[model samples]
Target chain A: EPEVTQTPSHQVTQMGQEVILRCVPISNHLYFYWYRQILGQKVEFLVSFYNNEISEKSEIFDDQFSVERPDGSNFTLKIRSTKLEDSAMYFCASSKPTGGNTEAFFGQGTRLTVV
Target chain B: AQSVSQHNHHVILSEAASLELGCNYSYGGTVNLFWYVQYPGQHLQLLLKYFSGDPLVKGIKGFEAEFIKSKFSFNLRKPSVQWSDTAEYFCAVNPPNAGKSTFGDGTTLTVKP
Candidate 1:
């Protein structure tokens, strides 16, 4: 089965530095999403992207966070200035449909550590 | 907002033991229920899902779940578990008519040999 792939399995950055997490979703998938899981916490949705634009985002997806589909196969999440609380396991997920009941395939997460 | 409730936080079992993990949701509308497993040092993998049709659903490996609409529950079960079954499991829910989803805090299962 086609799977989503994320680069930089682990990332360490200073509190004020910019960080970009990259994901290459399944080739045929049209809907992409970014989710985060704080250590010992439930997975939380951050943003959902479709057609090269954001369809929905949570309150945690503040001005400092942005997503871009720079190319056909790559989707990236940029954090302009990281905070200590930004450290978490970031997961990339994709689905062929954005409909309510469609199944999503999740990639192994990228662990981000902000110091 | 929809949310999932996993009653068990952690469970420990010996090889060949039977397993049952409880899961419930707080959505009044139709829901798409899912059970995902993340083995130690591995990515999340789908164990089972309930979209429609018969309440009883079978999935990968020896896992199964029964979606009880009236109870708003979708609990995962396996007749026998191996050490390989030791993993963190999450119960997730999404309204059948919506795009967003909510997941429960994971339950860590320890299977001893």
Candidate 2:
């Protein structure tokens, strides 16, 4: 089965540095999303993207966060400046936008660690 | 605010034992419910979902869940489990007409062989 794929399985960066988490969602999927799981915590939604624009976002997705589909296949989440609290496993997910109860597929996740 | 709550944080069961993971939602409106599982070293995978029709819904891996509207609950159950069933289970809910979903804290099941 085709699945979402994320790059840089493990990323470490300085607190004030920038980082980009990349994802290649299922080729045919129309909906994309970014989510995070702090250690021992429930997964939290960050943002959902569709038609090259943000469809929804959580409070945690503040000014510092931005997502873009720079190309047809890649969906990237960029954090302008990182913080200690930003450390978590970032997972990329995708689904069909047709919206008749479609299941979302998830990637293995990128473990972001800000020093 | 909409939220999901899973009552059991950790459960340890032996092979062939029955399993039940409690899940409840705070949303009082029409809702869609789902159960997802994450096995060790793997990404999260959907188990089952409830939209409408029969409250009893069966999912993959011989698992099933019943949605109780009045109780605001969707509990997952399996008559017998195997060691392969060891994983973390999450319950999620999306209120009617809402695009986003709220997820449970999750239940970690450890099935000993």
Candidate 3:
């Protein structure tokens, strides 16, 4: 089965540094999403992208965060300046909105650690 | 706002024991429900989903869930679980046309051998 693929299984960056997490969504998927899970916390939605633009975002997705569909299959999340609290597992997901079957397929996730 | 609630935070069971995890959501409109599992040091994987068919939906690994629309509940169950079933299970909900999914805090299942 086709699945979403994320690059750099783990990343460690210093505080105030920039980091880019990359993902390759399923080829036929029309919606892409970025979610994060802090240790021992629930999975939180960060943003959703469709038609090459962000369709929705959460309050946690402030000015520091940005998402881009840079190419046909590549979707990326960039943090301008990472904070210590930004350390978490970042997951990318994609789904095709076929009626009520908008079930997303998640990537293996990129573990981001800010020191 | 949409939200998911997982009643059990942690549960411990022995091999071959029956398992049930409760999930509820607060949404007023048409919604799609899903259950996902994350093994140790792994990413989330879909366990099952309820879209528009029958209320009872069976997923991989002998897992299943029933969607109770009136009560806003989608609870997962397994007839007999094994040690490999130990993982964190999450319940999620999304609107029919929306791309974002709101997830519950998750229930950690520890199946001892």
lDDT of each: 0.89, 0.89, 0.94
Chain B vs. true chain B: TM-score for each candidate?
0.96, 0.96, 0.99
Clashing pairs in 1: none
Q: CA lDDT of A60 in candidate 2? A: 98
**Model 3 error, position A18 (Å):** 0.2
TM-score of chain A of 3: 0.98
- Report the lDDT tens digits of candidate 2 across residue range B15-88: 99999999989975678889999887566788999888999999999999999988999999999999999999
Each prediction's TM-score against the native?
A: 0.93, 0.89, 0.97
Score chain A of each prediction against the true chain A by TM-score and list the results: 0.96, 0.97, 0.98
Lowest lDDT 10-residue stretch of candidate 1 chain B: B93-102
Q: lDDT per residue, candidate 1, A27-64, as tens digits? A: 98888899998887778999999888999999999999
Error of 2 at A98 (Å): 3.2
Per-model DockQ against the true two-chain complex: 0.55, 0.43, 0.79
Off by over 4 Å in 2: A99-102, B95-99
Error at A74, model 1, angstroms: 1.1
> How far off is each candidate at the interface, as Cα RMSD in Å?
2.5, 2.8, 1.0
Q: Give the better candidate number (2 or 3) by TM-score.
A: 3
Better of 1 and 2 by DockQ: 1
Ranked by lDDT from best down, the candidates are: 3, 2, 1
* Candidate 2: CAPRI quality band: acceptable
